[model samples]
Target: MADYDNSRYTYAQVLAGTGYYMKDDKLRYSAGVKTMQTKLNTAGYDSGTPDGKFGGGTDTAVKSFQRAKSLTVDGKAGKATLTELDKTASGGGNASAEAKNLKKKFGSIISSFASKNSIGEDVLGGFILTESSGSGFVDGALKIRFENHIFLKAVPSASTTFKVEDKVHYYKKNGKWYKTHTGKQTSEYEAFNLAKNISENYAYYSISMGLPQIMGFNHKVTGYDTPKAMFTGFSKSEDKQMEGFCTFIVNYSSGSLLKACQSRDFTKMGQIYNGDGSTYGPKLKANAADYAKA
Candidate 1:
């Protein structure tokens, strides 16, 4: 980041910048491209060898990174893409220390948020642990769980687009329609991207995001104008995700859920959050205990 010209990278509201690499450009070699390739590789996008060349592998990697980060899906290493790549690759993938780092970086914010919202601090920690494994991101991008059932119901066109008999995207499980490709970010987003082709708004609205695992349809209670806004904001930082989580806790069901959170009644919290009677109370309690020890 030091040797590279900042003018070449795009930051917020800065449009005079030049792109280091455009999508349609032919195979080219440069130190700038090499640096980007290195970062992309470090960020786990697999841009082939850092040969200082903008080739097909690098292009595909750039597009994958953009897709994961919720940036424009163009395969260009422009201002926004480069900037985010630098930030993401700056740190190593030390997942074992995720909980420690999460607390160390945002302990004050979480404590103050918990106090103000009358929620147990450990309860908040439990939610983060259970929802996102104490990290707001997965594989150098914001964590998301796409719901195919929600997507099918949210967008009428999706029902026709993906038939249950296909046994690929949709499947009937215990008399309920379920998404076959789910439970992992890569597979989930793959399905999500397919759904996005049908209806982008419904696609965004159907996913749960960040450490809080808050669904996009709850944007209004979380103080966002729309589901896309909530997705974008949550993708930027955990602080914004925390803000949305707190706001939603305070506003949802007229603060009754907040009362349950304060009382450490994770059964009620899970019932409200998951929409099923399968209370995650024991797991949440176990997570909180582990975080306390850590």
Candidate 2:
């Protein structure tokens, strides 16, 4: 980063200082935005793009990261926030007691999310099962499936009469999905799901924000109905969402259901049903076996 007068400092300076600029990349804030995105994401904040423009999504993602880390959520990347961010990358150091405290806080966030979203932990379990045993699925698809489960909510048809597809799965891609979990797909469904999940599930605005497009929910969100809390109102923020999702696994997520879902992974998605369990489950497994060329 080139040294310039502080009074004349701009976002460009912030990008340069952060090593996010380059002549080869033209508008270099994208790199800076990526750096910020990685840090914020690691901290459990889900900025939409990490494209390095001072946009609304970035602001919201910053606010969420600040909120999660207990920093002031003014949406401005000030010294304290930047310091914490930098130290976090370097593994947190001699900034102040606040920074050390921030580390502890961040640890708690990961742990909490892990505890709440045991599904995430076990989600790997399910993914591995299908990946290892249910061969013939699209390669690089196992990880994709893992991500799909985190953000989507599978609910039976309103009539509960067992439609062709047992349920329609919905989720937030940016604020809700990416914020809550991890993903990097470029599919149309992925993009649409990303937008829909944010808009429908969390109640954020249904418009583009900054680098990290923090979209609100499109309509309503759906989830399991069990143990009272299992139905909905899972996690709060990035940290808490991870927590809640993990917890849902402990309380309601079923390997059988997951297996069923995995079985259907080879078949057309959204075809597995609830009441037709006896019927669909076997068929799904058979279809997967065929897809595997078994």
Candidate 3:
């Protein structure tokens, strides 16, 4: 795996530093807004003078930039908008050779699935880039950290199902499952143990696993006969994770989402993939464009 720390900065930092989404009204002037105006002007979006003030002209320019980049047309310079701007201002680099190597490793699988589903390779590539940053693991692990509240919500009464001797929790360590007193265990280990225990007692459908974050409950829709099967498959390799993702997409929306991606209709794609009230569509579209360029 690549050792490069390619993770971007936080959204709040981008907004504060870049004047993203700082619109002019009766409010005070902001330096960030002026910086954004200057950057937009440099990029040929034409935000007028760098007055450190936002108005109709700035809004129009922001919207234009968003449209050109296939971002959400909310006319606000949110995290996605600012990130794109930063990339453009810096003359963004293509995907590293390491990234290319990873892509090549999974190329055949992606291609096969794309062909079977009649989806474009670029679309699938973009999806992977956005969803997993082109990696199935993070920090040398399988990206299987536990989410505490989600586990608690999924399995309410642990005593009945887990059958713990006392106030203890189960977890995984070095490929072996172990149990520890409730407060003594880390959340991450507890999440794994809880998921495993739940799958054994109740059903796997309640757990969410792998790159696509597909839930265990949706095993039927995703073509898995059991939750353990889904979890085990995902744990096998990145290729299997991709397989699970493709399966879910193909079964859930019947290729409509893929079609939306091909057409560059991020609004519809986001609604379908992430459900309503999500702003991820534009970001996904932008990331896909970047991956295609690379």
Candidate 4:
């Protein structure tokens, strides 16, 4: 397996730059390799979890994927093959510019969140987009991110706009592009839920000249009777507070979530947000389940 710790910095920092996200969803493009997949499968090559992630399993699968398709089986992603891969990714469906818009918006949202929340922009951005969508949600992107969790087979939501009524945080922990994970835990559900609450309700709006939605954030006070005494424009609305919390949620979900998955710590932040990881298994390792993803 190719072990490159460089998946950090280089991954997230790319988010700051526009046009970094894929125009099509990652799974959408990978599905395009069906022809290649069938060929490999016929030749006794294990395509390994056809969820659509181009990972070790996928790479191993690619040798067969490429060989079946009559291409060089070097196993590195390239343009000509990827272009064809994308064409078939949507399963013969067309990827309009609107989808690409979503990818860019998604990236921009994460990048902006890093700047606003003082989080590591590079790390956050890297988590923003993955190999799942052609480019995290860029124009023509076929991949869709439900919350912050990675999924190569992620499909575009019916409504591109974030709806208040949407369940929002129910993440799919299995059946992903790769075979890296297996199941979801209560904590994961909570993290995804809190993250959605923060993203859709708070961070999307609520601004106050850099302070955004903090009352005494710019002040050095020790409980001056009331919050108003320290700062005048503090919003008491829970929605406003949610925005503040959402900034951190994005930061956590985008970075910590990925790390947990890499190091098998998926349940860390979730426990911190849900209850206590010490009580429950610190990490809910992915097993043999439809939800399992790499």
**Model 4 spans with C-alpha error above 4 angstroms:** 1-59, 62-84, 87-99, 103-108, 116-255, 258-294
Give the Cα lDDT of each candidate.
0.68, 0.35, 0.61, 0.33
Candidate 1 stretches greater than 4 Å from native? 1-101, 138-140, 164-187, 274-279
Clash totals, every prediction: 1, 28, 3, 39
Stronger candidate by TM-score (2 vs 3): 3
Worst 10 residues of 1 by lDDT: 1-10
Against the true structure, whose TM-score is highest?
3
User: What order do you get sorting by TM-score, best first?
Assistant: 3, 1, 2, 4
TM-score of each: 0.54, 0.26, 0.59, 0.21
**Candidate 2 local distance difference test against the native:** 0.35
lDDT-sorted candidate list, best first: 1, 3, 2, 4
Query: Which runs in model 2 stand beyond 4 Å of their true positions?
Result: 1-34, 87-294
**RMSD (Cα, Å) of model 2:** 19.8
Candidate 3 residue pairs that clash: 19-32, 205-216, 205-217
Worst 10 residues of 4 by lDDT: 285-294
> Worst ten-residue run, lDDT, model 2?
210-219
**Model 3 C-alpha lDDT versus the unseen true structure:** 0.61
Q: Name the better of 1 and 4 by lDDT.
A: 1
Per-residue lDDT of 1-294 in model 4, one digit per residue for the tens?
343222222222332332121222233443434344443333234555444333555456544335434567676434444543433232334433433443344545544655665545333332222111222112321111223322111223512322222333333333221211122233333333333444532211121111122222222221234333322222333222223333434434345543443344424633643454432211121110101111
lDDT string for model 3 (133-237, tens) is 345554544444344334455677643433333545454545664554342225444555555655562334444566666776667566678876777777788
